[model samples]
Target: MSGVITGERRSADTHSARSGGGAFVPEATPLDDARAQLAVATGLLGYSDGLHAMLATPRRELTVAVPLRADDGSTMLFTGYRVQHNFSRGPAKGGLRYSPGVNLDEVRALAMWMTWKCALLDVPYGGAKGGVAIDPRLHSKAELERVTRRYTSEILPIIGPERDIPAPDVGTDEQTMAWMMDTYSVNTGYTVPGIVTGKPISLGGSQGRASATSRGVTHIALAALKHRGISASRASAAVQGFGKVGRDTARFLHQAGLRVLGISDQYGAIHNAGGLDIERLCAFVDETGTVMGFPGAEPLDRDLLLELDVDLLVPAAVEGVLHEGNATRVTAPVIVEGANGPTSPAAARIFADRGQLVVPDILANAGGVIVSYFEWVQANQAYWWNAAEVEAKLEERMLSAWQQVVDYATQRTLSLRTAATVLAVERVAEAHRLRGLYP
Candidate 1:
């Protein structure tokens, strides 16, 4: 099957650089942890300290005050941010999320992850991310549309087909992207589909892009299973989130012969020894707004899904699902990260110590950006590929990337997470050295 590797793992490390108190800054938020991640990776990748310091930070961050007109008779003000982590390679690209916990730090981290993610797949993009601190589920569609359109206008100066592009993150979707594309086009006097991806198919979005992240996670999980000589058809799996990524990933794996044992959403979790009816579970979540009341499965506390007995565990929900607190209790032999920064670096090491294989988010969930790049290319050319072509291309890219990371990890005697960081950081450093810093 041509399982040869591209190179050795880079050896990303612990955060030894001094913060204010010379104590390691906890890898809590995305930006704080992204800097720490780069610091560790720079050491392992052997970048010059100057370059390390420069790369440890983002290029720019813009925070806008989005004053929204609620469906009710009141006006509410929300804070939004867009952070372009690095654009040495190309225009910045990432998703814009909405959540009460969204912040500058988290946006920074996700943008940084985008950089490595692009580098890892050799895609022609840098990292960027935006977020707003609002509980989007609490609002009506009209209110969300207003907020999205306004947010798009506020960030319009830095966004376009050739500048930064936004996609769906947490609390966002094709409709949101449709609003963004429409808003941007209205400002420019033309339709520009490339300004955003993950939009409705009728609005020039790729057919499979919405499920790309979940598909990519499925690809990585199967690769891990194949690498360990475990037949996926005989394997059991658990998913820690029931959002788009988690839900679709479960359905894909189930269709591929894996037994999906448990699943969770924000509300709660459900489990069955044989396997949950993924299609049924999806329908239940669709109608009920959560997986708590599914007919055929028993419920578990949300936190306990991480330690479930399974062959592969996919954390597709929020960050920090596998942290210092729960790393020791995790039972899966492999963890395929579907969310950025799902596992703390130290916690990853603990998993490795226990002989577990972790496919980091950068490598595993890269299907979204790969297809986003396709959308960008199409937008620029004013031509679009069919759904079959897009799916074929996505499968090819993610499968090849998985083999590359796996090969590097095999050759370097390192974890896939370390190898992924090392490969990505080295490529980025080379790009930086070639471009040089401008005066």
Candidate 2:
């Protein structure tokens, strides 16, 4: 959705599977942002304290010790978590991330976002997230496979096609989903392709699944440009975190006629005022593993990418990249968050004060889950769709949700983020109210 309300205020606050050991860890910044956003939405809904508490708390959580025998015959223990934030709408759905910083609080926050994302997109799934606190980069393929299998086995009791389905997220990818799917199928004594999304196409993954998020972001970005009476050909953009989402987002933006002037990876960034050739840049990254030295573009600082003078800025890399320190420097008029929790509460407020139209990650990056929903439906029916069919449906669905959020915002005079959050929370709250609590 797209219009605006003059007044509204807020606060801020803001996963997974596989095999476990646990130690208590405090809440992280992203979780705090997630909660703050929730508070704003619930207050707007006029929900009671009891209802707010119920909405804030997770429906279930599992922490496990995942032990892996290394390639050198050494054993390492990692902590993993699977949190289901809510299931009043349907089964839990989210991604499995493998990162050294994974923690329960992060998982909780992500799961909570997934809940709203799914609800906002009208997907028949709640929010869930899983993560293992291990650095995938430090592990060999053999070692990573073992970790994925063991983690899947450890959380097998809580995950299933009809219960909680998993997909790929940060520090993980299609191969990770393949391992997870294989492990789950092995335990069930039968193949279950529906247990996961983002798997290989040969294994029942949806067509266009890999680029769904970027496509969705591009869809929204284009819509935002139109909302501002700007044409894509005249628009310029800078995308940070040139990984899965950022890479494709830049490419699609360029394809859609936007001057993609800046692109970044973990190592560094590159910029060309005339617009970088995304295809060649992708080839360079594919060959060199980073955007650090693309010959067509000049080197730029990674942090400077977000502050570049552009019409659209996509933060697709990791959480907190747009925190309090740099939020004020961001010059992009439109931000379609491609990463979960990329903007902190303080930063979001700054954007609001500056009158920058910030499309929250929940609505901006929901294309992945929406496509995952399609993948799951296709798997259950064993009816795969053609790429053209998938893309058309995706564009239709994304634009529809954007309009809905825009309409809500315009009608209520709320920010796009607040409107999207309020609509999602209201739907979930309605589902819960109808289901009612059992004694």
CA lDDT of each candidate?
Answer: 0.84, 0.89
| Tens digits of lDDT, candidate 2, 221-306 | 99998998878999999999888899999999999999999998878889999999999999988999998878979999877888
The collision pairs in model 1 are: 30-109, 31-109
253, model 2: CA deviation in Å? 0.3
lDDT of 1 at 239: 94
Model 1: per-residue lDDT, tens digit, 336-382? 99888888776887898899888899999999999888887887887
Score every model by TM-score: 0.92, 0.93
TM-score of 2: 0.93
Candidate 2 at 359: error in angstroms?
0.6
